[model samples]
Target: MTLSPVPDRALAELGRTEGGPDTLALLVRDQDTRRLLMLRAVLDAAEGADARVCSADARARVREDWALLAEADRVAPAGGGAAADRGSAFPGDLAADPASASARDTARDTAAGPTANPAATAPPGGPTPDPAAIAAAAGRAPDQATTSAGYIPPHPPLSPARARLLHPLVGPWARRCLRELGAAAGPPTAEGTRELAHDLAHFSALAAVAAARAGISYAVRLPARDGALVLPSLGVLRTAVPGGVPVDVVHRRGRLTLRQSGVADITVRLESGTGAWSAAPAWTPAYALPGLLSGAGPMPLDDLDPYRTARGGPRHHALSGPTTLDDAGRKRWLHSWSAAAAALGLGGEQRVGEAVALLRCLVPLADPPGSAGGGRGGGSCSGTRREAFGAVLSSTPPTPATFAATLVHELQHTKLAALSDMLTLHHAGPQERYFAPWRPDPRPYDGLLQGAYSHLALADFFQRCALTATRPAHRESAWTLHARYQEQVGAVLPTLVGSGDLTARGRRFVDQMVAVHERLEEHPPPRGQAARARAYVAAARALWAGRRIRPTG
Candidate 1:
C-alpha cells in the first residue's frame, strides 16, 4: 500500500505555522482561499527561516489545520473510483490515508449537493469558505484535464491562473499577448466572444497544471490594510481585483497574467446592471495579479531520514554522523584538513578535523540518498530554523565555517528554484555544477553533464590548498589524481555546450577548459607543483558570467 499524500490543504496550512512543520496536524480544517493565502505566507516564512528546516511557525500552522480537519464531518462519495489526473511520480503513492479519504468523500458530497441558493448559502459570519469543509477536500483530487490516453493538447492552454504566475521578467509580455482576454471575459452578446471565453478558461486550466508541476506559486496579490502585503512564499497578485469582477487573463512572454478593474469600474458595474456592458463602459483598472516563486534548495541527506522530523522536513537521526558537542572535543577534531605530513599519517591531531571538514565539505554538498542522478540539490536548507539545525547536529562536532558554506550552496539552488521561469531554468542549470540543462526534462543532467565544472572547481580548490599551504604535501600523485578529474571534465563538455542555459561567457569557459585540457600533459607548473590548478581555474571563470534570465517557452 502507498504512503499518505499529506493533503495539499494540510500542506498549505502546515506550511504556515511559525514554528515550522512540526505543528501542522493533518486533520485541520482550512478555507481554500485562506489556504492559498497561507501558501504565500508560509513560503515566505520558509524562505525567511532560510537554511532552517521546519520552523515553529510552520508547525503551529500545521497543527491548526489538522485540528480544523478533525472537527469536520465526513460523507460518502457518489463515484467510488479514485479521480485520475496525470500519472503521479508514483501513482496513488502520494494519496493521503483515512482522514484524507474521509475529506474526499465530503468534497464529492459537496460538489454533488444542490447548488445552495446564493441567498441561502451566504453565511452571516464571513466570505471565507469553511475551513473544515475545504480541509475535507484533501482526500479528493483536483479535476483532470483529459483522460489517461496518450493525447496531448496541441497548445498548452495555461490555466486561468497560469498566465498570471510568470516571473517579473516575463510579466509584461503576458499582458501584450493576452490583452484581448480582458474584453473576452465580460458577458458576451456575440456567440463568438462567448465561445472564446469558454475556451480561454479551459486553456487557463491546462496552463495551471503545467505551472504547478514547475512549482510556480499562483496566489493573486491582494492589497494590505497597511499598504504593504507580507507574503511567506513567492507568488503574484491581483493589485486591482474588485469584489465582483470576474478574473481576466493574459498569457504572453511565458507568463500568465490576471488583472482587476478599478473602483470606478466596479461602481459602474454595480450601478449599471441593467445596461449592457462593453470594454469602454466604466472600464476597470487592469488587474495586475502578480506572482513570484521560491525554492527549498538542495534536498538534504536528512530528508531521506523519513522519521527525523515531525514536520515534513529532514530529521535528526543518529546515523547522519557523530555528535561530540564539547569545546575540548571540538578542538580535538579540527585538524584533518592538512596534508598527510600534517596529519602525521592519519593519527595527526587534525585528522578528525579534516574528516569533519571532508564530511562538511562532501556531505553538505553531496547528493541526497536517492537523488544522486539528479545532481546535488539543496542539502544546506534541510533545517527550517537554526534551532532545528542545532538539534539535527546536536551530537556531531560543530564547524561553523563549513555550516555557513553549506548554506551558501543551498541558497544558490533556492534562488534558482524561486525564479518561476522555465527559460531562466534553461539558463541556470547548465552553468551550475550538474550541467543539467535548464529545460523541463531532466535527462541531460545525466551522462557526463552531471559533474564536470564543479569537479573542476573542487579540484582547483583542493589543488590550491595543496600547493599554497606551507605544510609538507604529496607532490606526484596529486597531479596524477587532478589530471584524472580533468578527463571526467572533458567527457561532459558537449552536454555543457548544448545546455542552452549557459551564457556566452559560460560557453567560452567550457571551450577554454577543453583547450587547457589538450595541453595539460605539456605544462607542468614547476618542480613542486603542476599546471592543473591554474588550468581548471581558467575553465571555471568562463562558466561564471551571465545576465539574469526569464522563461522563453
Candidate 2:
C-alpha cells in the first residue's frame, strides 16, 4: 500500500481535526493540586462563546431540565442487559451510607452558579454534545466522582470474577457485556483501541442522562496549549449557586468537578487542576439522530458522534456504520436469530433469519464471560442447552433487517460447528475424533474471516441492491440469491473495496459490495429476471472476489 505522502505537520493537524484521538496517549503524571487548579483556570478561558450561565433562575431551569432527563432515563429500557450494566461508583444507596459527602449531596440537588454545560462552551446553538468532545472528556474523568461527562455510569469494566459479583447490580447478561467491553477497551491490539474508545463513548452518551438521574454535575477537562489541564465551565461560579443542594461541583479551585448539574454547578476539589476553558454557562440536551429516526441509510459517519457521546465506535461494522440501531433493536436481532437457528438445517438457508442467528452465536465469542454457543443446533448437542439463552440476546434488540443479516452471518458459525460435529460424528471408536470443529481454533478475523465476511456482506448488499437499483417495492418475489449465477459478474469483492489496513476478508467484503453497488448503478435496472439476473451475476463475481476469508471453513 502506498502512503498518502502528506507532510508530518499537515498529518498531525489533520489528526487533530479528526478530534486528536491520540491525545489519550498523553498521560498527566503530575498529581499536584495547585497545578491542576491553574489548569482548570485555563480551560475556563477557552470556553466556547455560547457556554454561559450566570443567574440562579437559569440554574433552576437547568435543574428542571435535569429532572426531565432523569425521568426519561427511568423510562428508557436498560438494553436487554446484553451489554454489561456497569453501575455508577457514586454509591447506589448513598443516604444511609456514611461515605456520602454531605456537601456533595447538598450540592447535587441545588447549586446556583452555572449550568453543567455553560453557554460559552455549548455546541453551536446548543446542539447535542459532539462524540469527539465527549471522547476527550473520558480521559478527563473527574477527581472524586466515578462519573464522567455528566453521568454516573451504572458499571465500570469488570473481569469475569468481578462481573459475577456485580451481576445483581448490572445483571448477569449485562455483566457479560461489561466484562467484554472492558477487555475490548483495554485489549492488546489496535482493534482493542477501537473497542475501548467505542465503549467509553457509548457509556458517555448514556451518561448525559445518567448524570441527570443521579443529579451529578460534570465539567470537561481539556489540555491547554501549554500542557495544563483545563476544565470547561458548564456555568457554576459565574452564577450564584444555591446552597443545601445534594450534589455540588465547583470548578473554582481547578480540577474538573462532579456534582448534580441541576441547579447548582458543584465542583469536586481535585488536588490538581488542568486548564480552564471558557467560563460561560449553558448546555444542550441530546436526542437520537434525525436521519436514523426517519429510516434513512448512510449519514456521514462523523454525524453520529453526538449520539455516541464518549469515544470509539460501535461493536461491529453494521453497528458502527452510519446507521443507528437502539439497544432494544439490537437485542431483538439476537432473540429472533436464536429462534430461527434450528430451522436453517445447519447450513446456509439463503434467508435473512439464518444470518441473524449465526451472528448472535458469533457475538458471544467477542467476550470471555459469556457462555459459548449451546442454544443453536450448531453449538452442540448437549442435553441441557445454554445455561440461560436469554443471557446474551436478552440485552440485544430485535430488528427485522438487522435480525436477517445477523442470522445469515451466524449460520456460517453453525456450518463451522456442524463441520466440527461431523469430525466427531464419524469417529471409528470413542477414542478417535472424526471431524475437527472450527470452534477451538484461533479466529481469522484479520485474515480469511475478513475475506468470507466481505463476500457475504456484498452478496446480501447486492440482494438489497437488486431491489434498490430496480427500486422494486412492487415486485415481492423477484428477490433471489445472486451467487447462483456467476457469468454476468461485475467485479470481485476483494479487489473492489479498499481500506487503510483491512484484513483480507474485510477488504473482500467491502470490495464485493462496492462492485455490486457500482454495477447496479451503472446498468439501468432491467425488468424481471434480467434485473435479478444482473444482481445475481454481480454477487457471484464478488463472492469469489476476496481470498479464503474462513481459511478452511
Candidate 3:
C-alpha cells in the first residue's frame, strides 16, 4: 500500500531527537492509515481464499461482517473532525488497488492539512464516523432484521475511535497470517489452513463486537477462547461453558450484553459520549494509565492483548502475558507515573506533554530487585514495537527521575519506529554488528542506530535536568548522567556516519543528529565529571573487547 512521505522538515526535527506533538501526531495519523489499509488487505485475502485455504463458512462470515463494516463507514456522518481523534477514513477501495495514484496523492495531501486539533476540519477520505454515536445509540434495541444471521445493522454507524481500536487487535496478526496463507509454495496443510481460517473467523467476531459497541444494535456469534471472550482495549468476559460455544454479543443503547446458550447473560454499561466503560461484575476491565499529564487523555495500561510482544528480538526486552496487578500493585504504578510526570516536567513541560501525547498504551513489566527507592539499577527498561505503534512496554522505575528519563528515552524509540515506517533510513544488507557503548552485547547496525538516537535524547534530557535541578546533589547526578551519555553518543556518531549503511536520507538524518551532539559538546561538563565519563566509556569498551570473538580465516 502507498504510504505518506515524511516531509524533510519533519524528518530533520525528528533527527534532532525532538518532534513535539504536531510532528508526532502526523506520524501517528499515517500509521493509523497504514493499518486501515492492512486490515482491508486481510479482508480481501480472506474473501479470495479457496476451500483448501479457508472453509466456505468462514469465508462467508468474513465477507458478511466486512461488508457490514464498510456500510457503516459509508453511511457515517460528515464534518466529524480530524482523523486522529475520530480515526482514519475507511479505505473503501484500498484492498482493490492500494497503490493507485489517487491513494498515493491523498497520503501527501492529508499531511499538509490541519491535524493539530481534534476539532480541526475532517481529513480527506470521505466522511468521518462520529465517535459520539456510542452515546446516541445508548437506549435503542436492534430490530428483528439486525439480529438475523445475514443482515446488517442499519442506521447507527461505528465510532471512528472504536473502529481504530480494532486495528491494533488484528493488524499485526493479519500481517503474519496473510504471509503464511499466501506462501509461494501453496498454502499450508489442511490442518494449518483450518487453524488460520479459524483465527480469521475469531478475529472477525471480535471486530463485529467492536463495531456493534459503537451504538449499532446487533448480535454476533463470538467464539470464546479458554472459556473467555476477549475484547481488545476493553475487557474480557468469562463464562462457565467451554469449547466453541455460540455466544451472542448484543448491544442495545449503551449497555452491552453477552448471552451464551446455557450461561447467564453478562452486561456492562458504556459511558455516554466516550469509549470509557463503567464497572461490570462479569467483566475484567483493562487497566488504564492515570491521566497525570495536563490536557492528555488516559492511555491504556495494556496487559491483555495477545500481540503485545516486543518486535525485532529480545534485545529490545519486553514482558509478555496477561499480567494483572492487585490493588496495592496498581496503586504503586499510579503513584510512580504521577511522580514521573512531575519529574519530567522539571526537564521540559513541552517535551513531557509531547511524550504523553505520543503514548497510546503502557505495558507493565516487573521491576528489577534492589532497584526500589530510586536505586541506580532500578531504572525503567522499556521497548516499542514496529507494528504496535504508540505502545510502550516498560518496567516501573524506583525513582521519578529515573522514570522520567525512561519516558524520554522510549519516546525517541517510539518516534524513530514511526519515522522509519514512513522513510527508509538505512539499506538492508548482511548482518553487521558494532559496539554500542550503552549495551553490553554488540548490536546490529539498525539496533546501534536506535541506541544512538535514543541516547541523544537521554543526553539532552540529562542536560536540561542538570541545568534545572534545584538541589546540588540532584544537579550533580544530572550532570554526571549528561556527561556519560554525551560520551557514549559521541563514540557512536562517527561509526554511524562511516558505516556506509545509510541511505542518502539516512545520511541526512545522521547529520542532523551530529549537529545536535556538537551543540551539546560545546558546553562541556566539569573537569572531574568529564574525566569520570571518559573513564566509564573506556571501561565499557575494554569489557566489550575482552568478550569479543575475533573471526578466523
lDDT of 2 by residue, 1-553 (tens): 1112223332222211110212111111111122223222322321211122112332232233223223222221222232224332221332123332222232233233223322112112222211111011111111212221222122222222222112111122222333433323242455543343332322222323233322344432111112111121111122223332223333332233444435544333221001123332422111111111111111111111222111232233212112233444333333333233222211122332222211211122111123242222122111001211111221132222322333344333333222222122111222221111112222232323322433343344334434433223322321333332222223323322332444343333344445444554443333554566665555543444332245664
Candidate 2, after superposition: displacement of residue 545 in Å? 14
Measured against the true structure, the TM-scores of the candidates, in listed sequence, are 0.26, 0.26, 0.79
lDDT of 2: 0.27
Local accuracy of candidate 3 as per-residue lDDT tens digits, 194-217: 557556755655555445433455
State how far residue 128 of model 3 sits from its true place (Å).
40
Clashes of 2: 143
User: Model-by-model lDDT, in order?
Assistant: 0.27, 0.27, 0.61
The local lDDT score (0 to 100) that residue 321 gets in candidate 1 is 32
Off by over 4 Å in 1: 1-450, 469-473, 498-553
- Candidate 2 off by > 4 Å: 1-209, 213-288, 294-447, 467-553
lDDT of 1 by residue, 353-440 (tens): 2222111111111223443211122232222121111112212212222232222222222222221111111245322234322122
Which candidate, 2 or 3, has the higher lDDT? Answer: 3
Model 3, runs deviating above 4 Å: 20-22, 71-88, 91-158, 161-170, 184-187, 194-198, 242-244, 272-281, 310-322, 368-380, 428-430, 550-553
In terms of lDDT, the poorest run of 10 residues in model 1 is 289-298
